[model samples]
Target: MLRADNLTKKYGDFTALNGLDLSVNEGDIFCLLGANGAGKSTTINLFLNFIEPTDGQASINAMDVTLHDRETKQLLSYIPENLMLYPHLTGLENLDFFCGLGGKSHTQDQLESLLRESGLQADFIHRRVSSYSKGMRQKVGIALACAREASVLLLDEPTSGLDPKASNEFSELLLTMKKRGVATLMATHDLFRAKDTGTHIGIMKEGVLVEQFASEEVSFRDLEKLYLQHMHN
Candidate 1:
């Protein structure tokens, strides 16, 4: 579970995020829809403790992230827009290394199984990451999340560059995580994908959360119209 209570962040005269209140519970995929500088990444950074909040709190599983940085980190996994992995290492090798950083040790078979469950092909699991497409790298990232048993996942622009097929594949993978009780908070520009995969959708503009609703309550066209209205306002 993830919660942000009146979270605020400011950089000198510029307010990056202001009074953000959000919650993502188990089995929830919350998608944040916003353009550049809409405070989406700032919200995530605050939750990750990558940057401290200027006001209020960012919590994971009811523990304040600022007060329990290490413990909160142990309960979550993050995937940024650009997933960085050891390019020369095989997918399995990368999974093991990242998982190890989280103090998770897995055998070759166990690691491979995680990758497979993350929607990776067995043939590519042993291949070096340098030869992988972005989608492949992201699958390994998901595997690392599973290997760590992360209960919360924070994703920022995860489907930015993937083709439709790969994007859909990634969406399916997220549904799998949801079924396993992983709460997900994702910042994405793909409205269609958000509608397809998110349980809740929020529109943010100029550092404020302007609109939010259950995905099924609004059609995709309605969501897009509301999003554009907020962006223009």
Candidate 2:
């Protein structure tokens, strides 16, 4: 679970986030939508303690992110817009490296199994990342998160460059994580993916949360219309 109360951040004259308040419960897929510089990543950065908030506070399960940085970080796993892998290493090797970095060491087979769990195919397990596609790389990213047993997943445009099949597979993997009750906070530009994968959606603009809704309470079509109106406001 995560909560932010009146969260605000500013860079001199530029306000990245302003009085943004939100709560994400366990197993909730919260999609944060906005234009190019709507402070989506700023919110994440504040929560991740990558940047300290100029105002207000963010917490993970009642622990303040700023005050309890280590504990809060341990509760989260992040997938940024662009993930980097060791180009020369195999997919399984990448998985092992990140897992070990997290103070968890798994054997070769264990890491490969973790990859399989994240929907990475066994056949592609040993191939170099240099030869893998974008989607394949992201699958390994997800595999790293699972291997670390992260409780909260923060993703930014996770499905961006994937082909159709890979995108769908990635979506299915997210569904599995949801079933397992991992709280997910995702910032994505793909509306269709947000519609199907998100339990709730929030529209943000100029550092403010303009509107929000439960997926069940509003149709995707209506959300799109509202999104259009909000951005142009």
Candidate 3:
């Protein structure tokens, strides 16, 4: 559902992403592990069409993102490190508003149901988003995906500031979407979350994808050792 083909992005003398070739199929949660400036967010932005690729392409469901920006965007949802919502709006209102932007409409009951399924607490649905923790805001993003029936999810550092429990909750929500055949490409620094939540893990360094493997192939300790080795090189 997501693909990057020799995707390269450069700014003058600097190459932010270097010939990245990747694919995330239906029901696959592909987590990207890398240090800062390793091109993780660059990959996500290329897919989102937030920035144009210098060479090659990023596509969703066979539609080239730059060539068919609107159509490809309709097939995916993006959750950045810090999700932004109107502080005065309730979670339900924010969900409804964003859904409307995507040309999706849901009744109140359906909207509430979606939020609940995304793991939002029932009592907080009507409360102002200003009071929500980072995890709660992310749940709304998931709800938006459900409402839109998005086939792909692009997440960048999505679990960064959350407590372990909240991060785990977010991972559970991703698993739920995975079961429904949504493809996910996440950029994260957390090795444990990547191992526990990802079906596949990739390590990138200096704009190159240096390692890729099935998550079950390595234990947590080995993954850490491998990641550190790459970082130190």
Candidate 4:
């Protein structure tokens, strides 16, 4: 449901991404691993149409994102490092409002159920978002995806600051989404999460994809060694 064909992005003479070719089919979780300035976020932004690509194409469900911005956006959900919701609004209210923007309407009970399924505690659902923790806010993002019945999920550093337990919870939610045939494209620095949660993995260095493989093809220790090898070189 997601594809990038020789995707390239540049700022002045510096290329932020170079010849990135990738595909994430329905029911697939593709994790991108890279250090800072490795073009992971640039790839996400291009798919989001947040910035126009300097060359090549980024598409969703075979439709070029740049050409079908509105329609493509309707088919996908994005969760950045920090999800921004109205601090004054309760979690349920935030979910409802975002779902409404996507043309999805649900009863209050249904909305509450969505949050519950996303792993938000029932008591906290009605509480103001300002009182919630980072993990709680991210569960709302998951709920938003479920409510919209989104076909694609684009996540940038979604687990960056979460504690191990919270990050594990988020990964479990993603696994549930995968069972529902949601294609996920996530850019993260967490190797263990990427290996444990992803079906496919790619490593990027200096804006180029240096290695790509199936998660089950290697041990976590080997993956770490390989990643470290690249970083050190």
Candidate 5:
């Protein structure tokens, strides 16, 4: 459902991403692991059309992202490193507002159901977003994705601040989305979570994809060792 074809991006003398060819099909969770300036976020920005690609293309469902910006956006959802929401609004209110932006309108009960399915506690749905923990805010973000019926999810540093329990819960929620055939491309620094939730894993270095493989084929220790080796080179 998501694809990057020879995707390259350069800011004058600095290349943020280079010749990245990737595909994330329905029900697949592709985890991108890399250090700072490794181009993970740049790839996502290309797909998001937040910035134009210098060369090549990013697409959703065979539709060119740059060319079909509006149509492509309707097919996917994005959750950045810091998920933003109106601090004064309740979780339910936030859902209602975001979904509305996508031209979707849901009843209160239906909206509440989405939040619950995303792992937010029932009582917390009515609480103001400013009072939410990072994990709780992420759940509401997931609910927004669900409300949009988005087939593709682009996540950057999704588990950066979560505790072990919250992180595990987040992983479980991602698996649930995968079961429903959501194609997920997650950029994360957490190798353990990548191993737990990803179907495929990719490592990037200096703006290029250096290695990729099926996640099930490698143990966590092995993956970590390889990641460290790439970082040092």
Candidate 6:
């Protein structure tokens, strides 16, 4: 399970997050939506420990993030909006080296299979990242996350640059992972994808979670309307 207990962040007199609390269970995809500067990224950053909280706690499986940095990091795999890789290196080598940096090593065949599982084309596995498209790079990012073998997956704008077909493929990969009991917390601007992929949805406004809804209870169109209503108010 992943939980954020009244997590708060402040910048001098400005508050980026205030008493934001959430819980995501295994096999759950919790998609967060918000207008610009709503603190969706801040919430994810708190879990990644990129920034310390002014108050409250974020944890995985009940392991407090502040006290369990190494252990918490071990349980998480983060895919940022722009997943950076060495353009000079082939996809395989990039995954190999990055995962190795995290103390994970894999055989060539294993790496290829993992990439394919994450929706990368088998043919592109040997291509240099410079020649690959955005969707391809994101696939490699997801592949690395898979290689990390963590209990939780954090996706930030995960489908930002993919074509319709590619985006659908990525969504399918996420659904597949959910079936395997992986916890997912995705911060995205795409409400359509959020409704389809999210087991739960949250709307953040000006550093607060103003509203939340269950995916099963609200249709995608309804969620969009509700999202706009929250953003406008």
Best by TM-score: 4
Residue 165 lDDT in model 6? Answer: 88
Model 1: residue 150 alpha-carbon error in angstroms: 0.9
How does model 3 score by TM-score?
0.98
Q: Of the pair 5 and 6, which is ahead by TM-score?
A: 5
lDDT of 4 by residue, 1-233 (tens): 99999999999999999999999999999999999999999999999999999999999999999999999999999999988899999999999999999999999999999999989999999999999999999999999999999999999999999999999999999999999999999999999999999999999999999999989998999999999999999
Point out the worst 10-residue segment of candidate 5 by lDDT: 75-84
| Winner on TM-score (2 vs 3) | 3
Q: In model 3, how large is the Cα lDDT of residue 228?
A: 100
Query: The CA-based lDDT of model 2 is what?
Result: 0.88
Cα shift from native, residue 39, model 3 (Å): 0.5
What does candidate 1's lDDT look like per residue over 1-233, in tens digits?
Answer: 79999999999989999999999999999999999999999988999999999998999999999999999999999999989899889999999888988888889999999899888888999999999999988888888888899999999999999989988999998998999999999999999999999999999988999888999999999998999888887
lDDT of 6: 0.90
Q: lDDT winner among the candidates? A: 4
lDDT of 3 at 122: 99
Clashes of each: 0, 0, 0, 0, 0, 0
Regions of model 1 farther than 4 Å from truth: none
Candidate 2 weakest lDDT stretch, 10 residues: 93-102
- Model 1 compared with the native: what TM-score? 0.98
Q: Candidate 2 — which pairs collide?
A: none
TM-score of each: 0.98, 0.96, 0.98, 0.99, 0.98, 0.97
When superposed on Cα atoms, how far off is each prediction in RMSD?
A: 0.9, 1.2, 0.8, 0.6, 0.8, 1.1
lDDT string for model 5 (74-171, tens) is 98888888788999999999999999999988999999999998889999999999999999998898889889999999999888998999889889
Query: In model 6, where do residues sit more than 4 Å from their true spots?
Result: none
